[model samples]
Target: MSQIKGSSADQPTNAPLGALHDIRVLDLTQALAGPFCTSLLGDQGAQIIKVEPARGDMIRYAGPFAKDAKTHDFGNVFQNANRNKRSLVLDLKSAEGQEVLLRLVAQADVLVENFSSGVMERLGLDYERLSAINPKLVYTSIRGFGDKVGGESPYGHWPAFDIVAQAMGGLMSITGKNENSNVRVGSGVGDTVPGLYAAFGTMAALLEAKSSGRGQYVDVAMVDAVLAVSEVVVNTYDATGVSPQPMGNELRGFAPFNTVAVKDGEVALGAPHNPQWSKLCTIMGREELITDPRFDSDLKRWNNKTEVYEIVEAWTSQYTRAELTEILGGKVPLGPVLNAEAIFADPHFAARQMLCEVENPRTGRPARITGPAVKLGRTPASIRHRAPLLGEHSREVLLEAGLSDAEINRLVEVGATTINEEQVLIKESAVR
Candidate 1:
């Protein structure tokens, strides 16, 4: 533990709303999934103390760096995932650091980690050990696979990245154009989906802990979480002996639920069931086509999906996406295929506050970032603080741990901690 500097007289204020104001969280996770989960909790006023190894979280090196090109300065990916939290650099392998972690566990309401199966136990900080220190501490573990019961596979020990999980969890099977061309999802759905489940599980455990006056362990496996989202494909294979293939822009069980080419761009429309198909035909001035034996029912239209989509495209290609949207939008379900620029400029996104501007301390400019997906009316999510510089709050966090100034100086002198002096110097130089 390090000590406090600057104004030791001024105490740090709590989070604005303080929804989870008193709830202390020890975040021992890294990379995308687990960080994202804790970030969400931090947004709602959880006192998240991010315990980073001496080398820092791997995301610090994952780039989109500032003009100065400092590797450890907040990279875009790192900033996006880790906001509204305090960070402490500690070498968990060291006895002193492990003792500090144990102290934190004793005072914490939750301990979240995404280490491999046995790392916690190897550290002698597993649920069994920590529960003795604080019986009400919720221990949440995120892993690549479930270690309980017969669910543990031989690959449990092997490390996994987002791409590996996507491939192994069946997301790639139905994500591309055809059987030969399988595509992994563009985003880290495999990693993030599991994180989402883990966060939910942690919250549930907290609620339970309140009632039972005991803490429980939460196990969230990326493979299982990704597989849960891939249930449609699983059910399709189970119900019918046929495995679903990648069908680019086409809905698996519904007809006319695909993309159509317009004169200017493309639009997606969904005739979810039979009645919507009839409504679509009527709106297109093709009432006769609705009565045709080949397109009368949902099954019939599905059987002749190619021809049905071709007919729709013929009509669509004569008009721009905007024109078609005006003519048929919300009548039978329709939306234009908006690109990134268009999405940023969209009125709906603006109205919903889906995009927002946060001040970037490094750039000294407003950086546009995505707003919170989950909207709560009472306690709305916000970006109160900019992403921190490397070890920005080292002194403040150590002060919270009740360290003295001389002790912090000794730790820094001994090479156990660091600060972004270079970044501060750069900023000062720029101002001059």
Candidate 2:
């Protein structure tokens, strides 16, 4: 719908080899979960062709975009979620559009979507149809609940989001300060955790397809993903027959494994084991506590954690987080409660190459995004390209799909496809 100014991909011509170097993925999902899933694959060098609708991925408008952004087509959310992927715009509701997708699916190694359960069936592009065309196609889906391909759930048709997943997945039940003050996670783990699982499942399915010569469906439920990570809740309830409650900033069984007050903010410390607890007492000038009966072991200290935290806080409150970091940083598993500002300024992130500085292709201005977390020694993942403009790659992608220039023009002439002409120019000038 909008003027495009991007490319099929601004991919590095001689990029390093990646784990998924030979794979091609059709990214048909939007918002967080689906985009995030493909993003992981993209980082690992998968050829991710992000299939967006005529209006784009919806996130194209969800922006706190750069001040110098030349077009509204580039959104920051797109930068993080759809990086390393090319954007292709097609009106899937159109018969022509569905034909184009079927063409791509014929060669695509994988296809991922997050539409409500039956939307793919309605489009006649569901896995059954696509796999009939290409038996080696790894079909993947991310839903609020598990899809029928993965398993059965009564709530397949129910619409859900991050908050719903958190509420239903048992994460919020044990994530807050107390029984009545349950809070959602600071980030969208509900979407992202499921996305990560989908990525992993896709990889596993792809691996199996390599050996069996047939691709299978990989289904991921946001609720199940959340529960998978909340092992403490299930184990505690099963073993003790008692429900777990949020314990504020402290873990219940590990004394001093909690945030303590500091002069400017909170600093987390983990000296729960008796030896480290004794060392902490020495640092606090409370050496007598080494022999104290109430804190002689981890269990004893946990039993009296209230008193233990009070004593630790008395010492910590006198110092800033930085001061405490200098005093006890490497001696124990400790960290200051870092906000975004702190994280941005942290040198450790720089040293680890975690704060990646990527330029906005549309704006020709720079911004930072967190780099890939899963590092490999031989086949490292990277954030090599920025997000594409809406339907920025229509012509190039269509050409690659074996359509003639005339056919591409005909599609463009119809309401089925929208093309942006400027991305190729910008990409050649800026990147090439």
TM-score list, all predictions: 0.89, 0.93
- Give the clash count for each candidate: 1, 2
Residue pairs in clash, model 1: 3-408
Q: lDDT value for candidate 1?
A: 0.77
Compared with the true structure, what per-residue lDDT tens digits does model 1 show for residues 136-228? 999888888755532667888878888888888888888899999999999888778988898899899999999999998888888888888
Best by TM-score: 2
In model 2, which runs have C-alpha deviations exceeding 4 angstroms?
1-8, 68-71, 285-288, 425-432
lDDT of 2 by residue, 27-99 (tens): 9999899999999998898889999888888777877788888777677877888878887888998999999
The number of the candidate with the highest lDDT is: 2
Candidate 2, run of 10 with poorest lDDT? 1-10
- The true-versus-predicted C-alpha distance at residue 193 of model 2, in Å, is 0.4
